[model samples]
Target: MNPMTIHVKQQKHDLALAPSRVVFYEQMQLVETFDDQSQCHMLFFYKQKYLTAVRTTRLKLHSYVACAFKEGTVYESPHPFLQALIETNIPLQKYSYPQLKKKIARPYSRQEQAKILTFFESFIPKKQLFQDMKSLFYQYRREGNMSAAYRVIRVMRDFAPNNRFVKEMANDLSYRKLANLYLEESQTLMERDPLFKEMCASFEDHQRLLEKEGRWIEAYTHQLSHISNQPTSESYQSYRASLSRHFDSDSRTYILEELSQAIPSFQPVTEDLFHNHVVNENVNAVARLYTERELNLNEEQFKQVEALLEENRFNETPENLLPFMKRITAQHPDQTRKLLDAFVIRLLETMELEQVHDFLKAFKKKSSLMRKVERMNEIHEDLDCMQELGELYYGFHQLEKSIECFQMEMELKPSAPEPLRWLSKVYADKKMLDESKAYQQLCVDVQKWA
Candidate 1:
């Protein structure tokens, strides 16, 4: 080893002690130069976030890694070189300078360099896990088990609760020390538990694997299985999340229905799982949900729902607006039908094609909001939602589908020129001149007949 040049080779371990104002540095190092020799003692410095500070501690000739006590508000370090200089009262004029920078680790193998790199790569996202890791790291550090310490410290630097913790851990987790450490098995009894490793595999880990294997259904199945054992609101929430992630409403419904039947009590976990999970996500599913029982709102709330819908659209809402309407419909079918029709209309009316031509189509297919309106016609036999829908279809240039809707509307309200007029436009678009002219003439005839 080169003679002690009063410092060690260091790198910047970007860690903040406080917010941005109080930062820390690490990787204390010493360099030997060929030209001359001077006292080199500085290591770490701190600067908060981005603000310029006059007294900011930047790594310079005076930096020091420390262990000290405080006489008052200020701290004092007990580093050996610091103590030597302070006690001896060494003058700056006597200090000699060196030429070439002393290179460290040239003698180590590539494997050693890789191990040092690995230390920097390890980090845990969970604060608690990091803290636990640090506790383990310290135990190994004290025992001079540098390999385990490297592992633990690597995780800490990545996921430490704060930057100060990082700087402190960095000093102990120095790359220099890592060269001396070698990998070995854990000796502690707690770490010896087979179940511990199994438990360490988080839901995220399992999900990642399943997703990578294109087994979303398996992930969903796993969550369902996990919920069966745990049986908590959170577990069920995870189950719901898995359902959302893996399956569309159709598949989700199928999976959920099967799960509900298999686990009799799964249905009760959320009072309105269909309305909550299925209806909101699937438009066609909402149309099918008309037969199910509602849960919360009363008849009086229908007026409020209408007033609320009129005031501001439920464009961005968190409340279970769909199920709340379901509850209202349970009480007042006629009024609820009207309000729901209006609500669905508002969404459909605004569902105009924006930049993407398929935006409205996507929305219509996804949320089943338009299906909700169709259900209103089923309940009341009054709101001719098909007429409005046909117009919407025509607006979207879905000619054949528009004609179907208009034809359906005409069956409900015969002698209506609206459908005849739309059929004419669609035929024109299809280049069926005869049929287009025929409907065009029939539109005028219907108007006169009316």
Candidate 2:
């Protein structure tokens, strides 16, 4: 089979106005079209998609792999690279790069030098590609080839979607002959690029045309996506203002529903959704948000959650209310303790020792908390539970309560030495030297008997 020929066919007249078109032919038949001119490939059509066999030096034995490029992203099949070649129209099994040398062994042929040059230049670094695309964009603009200029800018936009200059270039192109092309490309790119999408929506022409065409949902989506991506106060205020200016109450509600759906992917959106739900005092939504994740709520939001917990106190479970209660502990100490009191009681009923200890250890021991742990003594009155509760109180520096628990445990099992040792430690912590010595001696006597 003859080698495939790849070349560009430039129009003879009006170089600035005409586009440079690249054509690929295998045995004198055109395969497919490519917008970017920098890619090296042996092109072919198979399975109703245009595929290119690109040279890859990364592979150990293989010279090339088949892949398809779309919108600046590469798509390669999961089939083994070798298997993809077998399915392709052209075979690239023998097209490997020559061994690289630091110094020339002999004068090389032109074909060998060209192959080496292409090999070295095949994989362009992302930063370098971005720079080259920007340079090409300016070159195309200087020649008044807006079609070619926009194509280069599109790739540039992909490289640096949030770049100010790239965005300006896009805006400049939107005013020229490529206005429709700019809008069309933006519509495609906006699906993936939030910053670019935000830029497109910011354009007056794009906004006016979109609304004029009864595509307000798309416009709303662009704004919502912008807020989701940015989530700054200014962006959110602008979104709210836009909603008030353009949308009715029903439309606003629908847009809010759309915003709520985006919560899982964009946490900032979740923050907004949570704010709205708290403002409306939607107990179920607020409760679900608590269960979803640990939210970083502000002071005002924490107050709102506190109010919600207070309002729903009659019906909600301690498990459902504890997270919000725990978060607002500093702001609403009384309310947090009240809910935690109930939560501790629930854990005691289940005898979930670890969970109960976690809650108790999280906060400083309040008078109400001591009363709550008394219920734990009421629930589990065995010698072991008494010894455990004694240590728990000792950890909180409640020395009197610790001694009380240790005395009760000693009464329940006079032979047990554990509570005697704990009583000694607790009394010493209270700076009661005489009591510490008494209990320490009792522990020694019990161990000696054993």
Candidate 3:
């Protein structure tokens, strides 16, 4: 594109001229003027529109009179041709046919002039051209216009490929906002377009690559984060399956590192596997590693690890469970439950029934009775864990403890009549008729509620 130079000329006319004077000298054609007069008027004549004309003036008196002719008739001007022409010494009268013919012999053709007008029209008459399109787009956007914006952008993108104004209009204010919008709208596009589906598949490929590298923890974390940012149940399931396949030996450092980077919460069954199978095997080794290197575990994580160590006796030689346990316990309580249950089961299985009972009794006695009761209440709400603990107590012939467990279970869930029935039987066995009658009545009441 070549640079365009525009020459501007302005003149002030003092006399009011009659319209009949304007003419085309070449064609001898008289020009028609509208009845309405405007302070500012611009006329564009090109070769395509008309032919060149020449004008000659033969002065008769000091007060000048001029004749003009184009394609048709010759006409006279009521006022003088020159008033006060500004910016140049060129006389306004010199703009007549004769002078115009002398200056430029050939003018633009009609087609050329039409093209120029069309180009100007493309941007001008702002309401008809740019205003409607711009207003429609912005109005659609203001209405949470995801689909509309997508359509508009797709269409307008071609109009202004390198235009900064268009780019700014299309670009999202922030990546996070862009991410969310894409997440919400991409699914629909992906369904409609194979190209979009391919893009999604590419992201999944990245997840697969991470898993293949034995970075199961990182892979899982990334998958979760991705899901949180852009939810898709199918993608989540695929990612989980991939993580499960890749997960092998527990590497606390690797898991922790990945957790820090990908998921700060860092509570996964994979982490527990690492803690129990890997870190527990060599407590000193794990502790030394933890202390020697930076541990990214937050305060909660540190507490979790400490609790795990205390409960599991990982501090013992050949199996330092302290750090791993601490880390696990510090995590979300729900996340820690499975590991805790497993640890408790293993601890009980290793010891004799009498020893386990004795330990439980002693531990219960040492801890605040109220706090222990609250903790029991918590466990009791979890039917599976509650049943496991109840059965354990029953195995030891701790009738009172067994009854207490059933009572707790009933308290936590009044809807389930089984616990009340069991409690009644326990009371009957102990010959506590009052308690038995009360539990039996409670069962009847619960059954009625059901």
Alpha-carbon RMSD of each model: 21.9, 19.4, 32.6
Residues 1-450 of candidate 3 have per-residue lDDT tens digits of 111111223245432222334332211122222223522222222211322221222222211111322222222332111110111122223143334433333343221222222222221342343343454456556887555544444334443346565576667563345435457756665554332243356557756655564434334544655664564547644644554454433323333333334443333423443354334554454454454343455565455554555564532531233344444345344455555444443434454444433444422212232233334445644665654456445544456667767767777776998888877877888899998999899999989988
How well is each residue in 1-450 modelled by candidate 1, as lDDT tens digits? 012222222233221111111112221111111212222222221110011111122232211212110110111232222222222322111111111101112532222222222221112124443444455566676988665555555445544435687676666535544423322223242143222222345666655655664544334445566666666676776666655553455545554554554464544543444444433444323323332433334344334445555445545431234554444445565555556555454444454323122222223232344453344335323345777766666654556657878788767777888888878888888999999999899889889998
Q: Which ten residues in a row have the lowest lDDT in candidate 3?
A: 79-88
Judge candidate 1 at residue 118 and give its lDDT: 24
Which candidate should be chosen as best, given lDDT against the real structure? 2
Scored by lDDT, model 2 comes in at: 0.51
Model 1: residue 358 alpha-carbon error in angstroms: 40
TM-score of each: 0.23, 0.34, 0.20
Task: Give the Cα lDDT of each candidate.
Answer: 0.42, 0.51, 0.43
* Candidate 2 C-alpha lDDT tens digits along 1-450: 112233332334211111112221110111222224433333332211222233334422211111212111121222111122223333222122222222111443222222222222334344554554565566666888665566556555544578898788778835465556446765664554333343555545555655664444445544565565556667666776777665554445445645656546556556766776777676666766755655666677767876775666525445555554555564456546665554554545444544665555555545465555655546455655787777766654556667888899999888889999988888887789899999999999989998
User: What's model 1's TM-score?
Assistant: 0.23
Worst 10 residues of 2 by lDDT: 21-30
Model 3: per-residue Cα lDDT at residue 33 = 24
| Winner by TM-score | 2
